[model samples]
Structures are given as structure tokens and as C-alpha cells.
Target chain A: MKPAHRKIEAPRVTVDIVIFTIEEAKLKTLLIKRKFDPFKNIWALPGGFVRSKEDIYAAALRELSEESGISGVYLEQLYTFGSPKRDPRGRVITIAYFALASRQKLRIRSASDAKDAGLFSVDDLPRLAFDHKEILEKALERLGNKIQYTNVLWSLLPEYFTLGDIQRVYEIIWGKKADKRNFRKKLLSLGLLKPIGKLRKGLRRRPARLYQFKTKKYVELKRFF
Target chain B: MKPAHRKIEAPRVTVDIVIFTIEEAKLKTLLIKRKFDPFKNIWALPGGFVRSKEDIYAAALRELSEESGISGVYLEQLYTFGSPKRDPRGRVITIAYFALASRQKLRIRSASDAKDAGLFSVDDLPRLAFDHKEILEKALERLGNKIQYTNVLWSLLPEYFTLGDIQRVYEIIWGKKADKRNFRKKLLSLGLLKPIGKLRKGLRRRPARLYQFKTKKYVELKRFF
Candidate 1:
């Protein structure tokens, strides 16, 4: 017979989100200034501890809303960071999530445990708290790779966008300039975008033809792309 | 000033491993028969609770060793499962991991909390305990997708293997027959395999040349592949 199993202590679990969006033709992420000690007042990913009765996903959504004042946007679990020394407050393991959304949709404000919150370009991030710098780098890498094979880049665009608008989102996330004609050709070949039969308004230059992402086509072609 | 945060209860965390190996040209996974309630006698992935002082990765390795009697193999964190109703023992969340190794190296036995342990082909798995079925399916899908872009499948092969042996591993994981010439052409064109300049000694037919995976080349060519 097996000996009685000993009760094990659980690690304190927290959820951190690296929320990405495209603003001013550049990729930006939301960050919150910590209000408490152990890197207090430094910028970090918006997150908090998981509540006893909440599921992990629910906890992530709650924390995202409380810290950034944004909700209902879908997030993907990027990774779990649990280095023994990652947290000074003793054995806290964090489940990291990444979300992509349109910059105009989020009305972020400092709330709950945060002192301040704002969007910063990925290229011009401040010195982050905890292992948040590492987390953001990993999230960016995931985003770059995901945009190539998935329709996830649509999350960073508005309801109706021109082909140039979509290409700029890709270029910003990928950190490189893409050939405009080739970029449109590749995306159009996938058949995941539908022309809106209208032009994007308010552009200084001639209005470009607008397109909307076809959710059904994107779902069908997800596996192949 | 922000209000002081209330102390929150942490969810009970565990680590579950989907140990995979290629045996008899079939992809097999190691499953342990649960000896305790919740899912008594049900075959499940080898796993256990995380200790207070152990890192998450270390906890995964320790649990894998205790239940399967196998150690030292590298494991990748697959995903975390934390549905509120996943475990009847109240708010238990599990970090799932997947490992690839050769069958001969593993000396698996039913140890620790497991009643019995054995290998089951991926296609013929028994109804697993605690959302393990979903975990295994995800791992298999990851393996299929990874084989195309990463050199991860090399973990399933012996150090010195023939081209045919490598092809068999791919066919087993992908569940499809690949054209021998095209497969060899693609893999060889990558320059990630080095020929040993020796032929199989025991074969009755013409001996095939042996080759070893070139880790350095795989690393350099990782981004493109």
C-alpha cells in the first residue's frame, strides 16, 4: 500500500496581460505603474492575483478590466513564468496572456492597484517591473509569428480598413517594411478579407478601397494558414 | 491613495505530463492508473501537486519522475487547465507538459500515487481523467504542427538513425504516408542532417546510410523553417 500523500503548499497565482494595439502606425502595449513596493511605481503589465472562487481565465479578464478599464476583448495565454526568484513576495507564479485590440476602442485609466496607466510604443518601452520586460518580449515574438499564419492581426484593425492600413499593422508588428503590392497580394490570396465597396474616409491622399475581415473564411482557413 | 488590497486565496496547483515515445512505429503516450478517488482506477497522465519551494518546471520534472519512474528528459509546458469543475478536490489547476523521448531509455513503473502504468497509442487512448483527453489531443496537434517548422521531432529518434527511420517517425506523428523521395529531398535540402558514412550491418537487404541530426545547423536555420 502507498504511504499517505503529504499536503503540498500551492504557489500564489497571478495573471498578467500584455495588451497590444496599433497606434500612430506603430505597435503599442498598455502598461500600468505599480503602486506598491518591490518595484513600486515602475511600469508593468496589468495583472493581479487569482481569486479563490474564480477560474483562471475569468481571473485574467477581471484583472485586465480592473487595471486597464478594458473588457470583452479575447486574450490568449502566452506562457507561465515561475522562476524561483521572479517574485520577491515569495513563490508567485504568473500566467501571462496577450491580447490584440484597436487602439481607439480602449479607454484606459489608472484604477484599482495601479497608480497610472498608458500606452507606449513597443520600441520605446520604459524600464519595466518584475520580469515584465521578458514577458513583453515573448508576447511580441508570439504576435509577430502569429500574424504570419493566423488572422489574429485583424484584432488590431478597425471594422473597415484599407489594404494599406492592414499592411501597416503587419509591418509594425513585424518591425520591417513590407512590399506594398506583395503584402496585399498574399493577404488577398487567402480569401479571408472582403471588400466593403467603399473607401476609407479622411485620408490626406486619395481614399483607398476599404475591406473587412471575413470571420467565416478566417475560421475555415485557420488550420491551413 | 489606492486602498490596501485584501489577501486572496490561491488555487491549488498541480503538474501533469503527457509523456510520449515512438514504439513499434506508433506514437504512444505513458498513462498512469489513478489509485485514489476523483477518478479512481482511471488511466491518466502522470502528475502530482507542486511543492512550496519548487519552481514550476522543477515541479513538473519531479512529478514525472515520481509517477513514471523516468527522469532527466526535457519537457515543454503545453498549457494550463483550470476550469472550475475540472477537479472535484476543489479549485485545482494543472499546468500540463509534453515530452518526447525514445521508448528504450525509459524504465517506467507504477510508482508513488499511481496504481499501474503503461503506454497507449494516441489513437486508442482510454477515457482519461480530469480533462486529460483534451490535453493529449492538444499535445498531439502541437507535435504535428511543430514537426513541420521545428527540429523537435528529433527527440523521438535515436542518435544514429537511417533516413527511413526518420521518415517513420514523421509518418507516425502526422498520421499520413509521405513520399520517400520528396521527404528525403526536403529534409536533406535543409542541411540539418549529417551522414555517418556507414551502413546498417544487420540488414538482409541493401544497407541504408545512417545520419545524425545536426543541432548547430538546426539552430542556425530555425527562423526560416
Candidate 2:
């Protein structure tokens, strides 16, 4: 009937990333020492303010590159944190992005915008600033649940990987041992992996057969997720 | 290292909702008339900027209550949207939430905040604003997948209801007619509903038996979805 009222609230929003990678048979996430006042001197996820010209995902990738110096990783939108009191100065909303990368890619060139940048084990993570620990937990839960149905685990594996490697990735992410037979059977049924007729080194027991991810299937079967 | 350069940028964040309920044998959502510069006069999900003092969930609930006048409904945090160009103005990230309610609870009190709040069928929803159309699609997909294992649909039923009522709720929400015979059998097998020895009213053919949700069992049972 009349002019609608506008909130006129310029809430500060930022993008935080939980960039995960498996290294030395353990799960690690990219962390940065805060150089700002809100959580100064504390360890936190790699993040930054969203630019007016960029979108949320772009902000996440930009923050990831600025804080961790890595790009084009398998990133997924995880959750948003808008707790009113999460930030002491004002209302700061943060969108979290979860990423998976192989151990080799963990050697990122720090963004130079943070006091320090490094990877930390999920199990022994330091106290993170502003509900990030909870955000990380939600991300892990999402990953645990999603890893069963999607081919996301491949993002944490090398270009060519064995079925055993894939199983191990699941085990580490889920923190539970899956039935090897069932896991292998389910993966094989997906029809997205082609046997490369090769074997990888560094196995105590028998080296398992290697397979390559079918990129074409990913495009055609976008519904797999 | 360089005292973390202060980025002169505005972080973008927004909120999306999957406000659904069962009404007239169909599941529906509350859509609003958007009369703004971006998506002028387009029918879109009612949402707003996240307030500084509230958490994302609280912000979602706040937006839901402000726009739909439906509060205290069981709301769940769904996911976050962060596509680079999802918002034309800037890089706006949106946190999505899904709310479930019975058909009777929705009360449209603010006609100015929302131009005629009414239930629209999920399948035949109006054109939405921003990436809200896609957000709603994802929410519906999540709901369909989740209804398979969780008793979340109970939130859409009355305190006491018939097996037929519950099955119909599932059918409407899933958009597929479920096998009535098997659906009833599976629900009963879950052992989460207790027959109250009461009969439903206003049945033309037969007065089906009424049952109360066994909340204790519902909590004890581990639902995969």
C-alpha cells in the first residue's frame, strides 16, 4: 500500500575458506594468523572481505589465493555465519568455503596479507577466531556425508590413484573404516573411473591398480551430486 | 607480514530461504513480490541483509518472521550461495535456510512488507529473484532426499494425524505419488508412531486411525538423512 521500509544495514560480510588437503596420511586445513584487531594474534581460516565487483565464490577464491596462494582447487560452498555478536566491533557475516586438494598442492605460497600461513591438522587444531571452529566442524560433517555419494574424494587424490588410495581418503575423512568390497563396488558402479592399467609406488603390500577420473562423465553427469 | 593490509572492499552476503508447509494436500512455499531496482516486481523468496547482532540462523528466522509472519517454526540451515555473479550489484553471498511448518500455522500479517503472502506449489513456483530459484531447487532436492530416512516430514503434520495424512504429505513434498501400501508399511515398521486409538474426523469413506508421534523413539533412532 505504501513505500516499503529499508533496513539500511551495511553489514560487513567476509569469505572464509577451510581449504582441506591430505598430507602424510592426515587431514589438514589452511590457517592464517590474524593480523587484524577483531581476532589479532589468533589462528583463523584463510579469508577476506568480499569485493563489490566480485561474488561470494570469487571472494572465497580470492581470499584463498591471497592467504594460501593456491587456486583452481575443488572448492564447495559450505555455510554462512551471521551471528550478531560474532564480531565485537560490528555485525560481520562470513561465508565459508570448503576445498579439497592433494598433499602435493599443500605447498602454497602464502598470500603475504596474513601474519603467517600454514596448514593445521583438524584433530589438533588451535582455537580459531569467531565461530570458525564450528564452521570447520560443519564443513567436515558435510564432507563426511557427501563423500559417500559424490566423487569429491578425487579432489584430494592425485591425478592417477588406486582404489586403495580412494578408500584411504574416505577413511581419513570419515574417521571410519568402510567395507573395502562395498566401497570398491559402489565406485566401480559409478562408471566415472577408467582403469589406467598402471600401478603406483610406495606400498607395503600389493600395489593396487590405478584409475583415472573421467572428466567427460563429470560434465554429463552433473546430477551425480 | 605487512600488518595485514586493510582491504578497501565490501564483503557481499545475502540470505535465501526454503519456507515450505503442507496446505490443501500440497506442499508450498511463501513467495513475495520483489519491487526493487535489481529484480523489480519479480516474485522472489523473501529475504534481506544479515543483521550484525544475530547469527545466520537467527538472521534467517528474523527474515522469515519479518516477511512471512511465521515464527517459531522449525528451521534448518541448508547451505550457502557464493557464485561470483549471483548478485548484480556486487559479490553478495547468500546463506540459505529451510523451514518446515504445518499448513495451519502460517499467518500473513504484513501485507506491506510482502505484497500478498500466500502458499505456492513447489513444482509450479513463480519466477524468483537473484539465484533464489536455484536455491529453492536445491532445498527441494535436499528435502526429497532427506525424507527418505528422516522423520522431518512430521513437522508438516498435525500433532495427531492418520497414516494416510502422513503418506500424502510425503507424496506432495516428493512430487511423486508413493505406493500407498508400501509407504504405510515402511512408516509403521519404523516404530516411531503410536496408535492413539482415536479416529480422524470428516472422512467420507472410512475414518482412519490416528497416531501420535513417538518423539522419544524419534530421537533415539539414528536417521541417516
Candidate 3:
């Protein structure tokens, strides 16, 4: 009876991180091939079981680090997937996190936990295991909608960036050409960007000005969305 | 050896509905007291196991009917909770759905599945089992934010309601007073409301006019948010 009770007490939970970075003018996500059973060798989001002491966010960051050797990125809870059949192995509940980093900044040294790891464009991802395709769709929608109302785009930006660079990221993620004038006008109206007295030098076009984040505005307008 | 290779399977999934209906100018949620062990006698969201044949949304709707006497309402997925220790007895993955209905339309009758069922104001909710409180918060935030952008407010309105009535619901959910003039202007800009040839009779002074929803706008502008 005690053994049966113990068996009933255990619950399986995992964390999956949807790491988005802009590469080759496209929004890409880090995915890995599972080497074990339950969709073995199939590509899936970098994820793993949560440890006893950590919270949901910590587990996602840990799994992300373990799979791709990346850490300390801005990670937010995307959503949780608890459909009983979402996991082919047992009753596994998976919490998904969305991590944003610049494409140029991401440095992955190893795909240790996964059979292999690589970045795939969000628009044309390979077949993923489980209900990950649905999960990815939801994450993309959430991220796109969030950037419209919240300053969530900042995490995907560098400390100093050109307006065109920001516009390109939005175009890549939103899947449309944003009215450049209106996009710049609306974001600047929010008073969250500050010019840093620097300009880009090597482009064939006009030299673009660089700006840094006004961190105070983000905290002050935390509930803007 | 062949028998040892048990095919991996997803655990039995369940969807819980947190239906909110406004009554007497208060935000309330439908709660049911559990009659079985593992948080027995605890107040919880009305829910049940998802059947093998039905989808998650269907399961949530069915559970809403079983636990409470309410049916055929506006429901949307809020979030899913799958922490390993969220359930004390076993690994039961629950997908949460938030349902909206006019408070006056809610009819709660005693049911066999739940020990008790009733609408409780969000501010004064009793001790609930599982991580339902967290789910409740997420649902509330989703509703609040959704109303600001979408015409989802129609779900809480009667066939015809005054601008003030709808605005009050907004204030109650957002916990802030919106400038009445600004509020009305924004709603009017949405062009989703139609002036019906009717007047409200309960006013002490001049009677207020009633407005009906423009159904076509609901579809044409479904992606407004």
C-alpha cells in the first residue's frame, strides 16, 4: 500500500525553452534532437526535468544552458503545456519559457544533452516531437502580440541599436512590413529610448543614429500593456 | 522482453473552467467544493478528466455543465499548470479555461459531481485547492487586458446595455477608473456597437439608450487586438 501510494504521489514535470534570436534576417529558435526514447532522434525544443529546489523559470534556464551552453538571458514564462497526451511518456507536464537574445550575441559551444542542436527559422522549422508545433505557434503569437503592447522587444535588442535594426526585427517576427515612420513615431512617443551620441559607419546608406534603453521608463510603465 | 517494451502514452488530461460572471456589480468566479480526498472539502475550479474522444475545450465545457448549471458561454484558454507537486495525489495535468457570462444570466443549481457550487467574489475567495489561485490571477489578467483591446466585453453585456454599465465592468475588472469621455470615445471608434431603437426604463432621471452588438464587426475586426 505504501509503495502504491508513493507511486501515485510522483508527478512528472519538464521545462522547454523557446530561445528566439534574429539570424540571417529571420527569427530563429534553438532546437535539439532527442537521443532517448519518446521521440528519440526527433528535433524538439531544448528542455528537461525540473529539479526539486528551483522554480519554473530556473528550470527553463537550466535546461536551456544544459542543451546549448547558453545562460543568463532574459527568459519569460511563455505558457504551460499540460495536456495528458502531450507527452507520450507518462503524465508529463511541460512549462515553456521564451528567451530572447541577439543573433550575434548567442554563443553555443556544445549540444551535450541533445544528440545535436541548431538554430531553425521560425517560419520553416522541421517536424518537432510532441505538440511542440502547436506550442511554437502559440509562442510566436504571444511574442508578436506582446511586442506590440509591451517593451518585450527590448530583450531581443542590443544595448545600443539602430532604428532600422529594430524595425527589421519587428518585420521578421510580425511577418509584415511595418510602416517605418509610424513604428518609429509610436515607440519614440513612449519615451523609452535615449540617443547615445553614436552613429554606424559602414553602410552604403545614410549613417543611422544609435540609442540606449531608458530603463526607468520600462519600470515606470511596467503595466503599460 | 517484448512485453517490457511498453509503448509510451500520454497521461489522462483534464481541463478546468474558471467561469466569471458579473452580478450585483462584482467580479465573481464559479467554484465547487470537492467531495473526495486529496484536498477534500476544498473549494476548487469546476473540472473533470478529459475523455479520450473529446478535445480539451470540450472537456472544459462539459465540466462546467456538470459542476454548475451554466452552459453555452464564451470560453477561452487561460493557461496550463503542470508543476510536479501541484497535485498531491498524482500527476493530473490541468488546462485552465476562462468563461465569461453576464452575472444576471448565471444560474447555479446543485449538481452530483461537486459537493457545492456557487459564484464567489474574487476579493473574498475561500481557500482553494491546488495552484488554482495562480490560475485565477492569470485568467483575471487575461480578461482585463483583453477587454482593453478587443470587443470581448460583449460577452459580459446583455443583448443591450448602456455605456455606463459596460464601463463599470471595465473599471471593476481593471481596478482603476477610466476617464468616462475617453472610454466612450475609444469604444465608439471600434464601431462594434449599434444603436438599437430602445431605452432603459430604470433611471431616476432621463432614460439611457441601449446598444446592440454589430455581429459583422465581430468577424471583420476579429483580429483588432
The candidate scoring highest on DockQ is 1
Docking class of 2: acceptable
Candidate 2 local lDDT, B1-225, one digit each (tens): 123334554444567778888887777888888656678777787777776455677778888888767776678878877676776665566788888878777775544545555678886877777888888988888787767657777778778989888878877766678788887887798888999998987858888999988882223234421
What's the CA RMSD for each of the models? Answer: 3.5, 4.3, 4.7
DockQ of 3: 0.20
How displaced is residue A155 in candidate 2, in Å? Answer: 0.4
CAPRI verdict (incorrect, acceptable, medium, high) for model 1 = medium
List ranges where model 2 is wrong by over 4 Å. Answer: A1-7, A201-205, A216-225, B1-16, B34-41, B81-93, B216-225
For all the models shown, what interface RMSD does each have? Answer: 7.2, 7.5, 7.0
lDDT of 3 by residue, A34-84 (tens): 887678899998887665544556677777777666665677787766565
lDDT per residue for candidate 3 within B1-225, as digits (tens), equals 013223232233568888887887889998988887778899998887666445566677787777666665688777776564677654456778888888666778656756887889998999998999998998988887677557766778778888888889888888878898988887788777888978898769788878888872223243332
- Chain A alone, TM-score for each of the models? 0.91, 0.87, 0.88
Candidate 1 local lDDT, B87-131, one digit each (tens) = 876777889998877776677888777889999999898989989
DockQ of predictions, in order shown: 0.49, 0.43, 0.20
Could you tell me the lDDT of residue A215 within candidate 3? 81
**Candidate 1, TM-score of its B chain:** 0.91
**Top TM-score prediction, candidate number:** 1
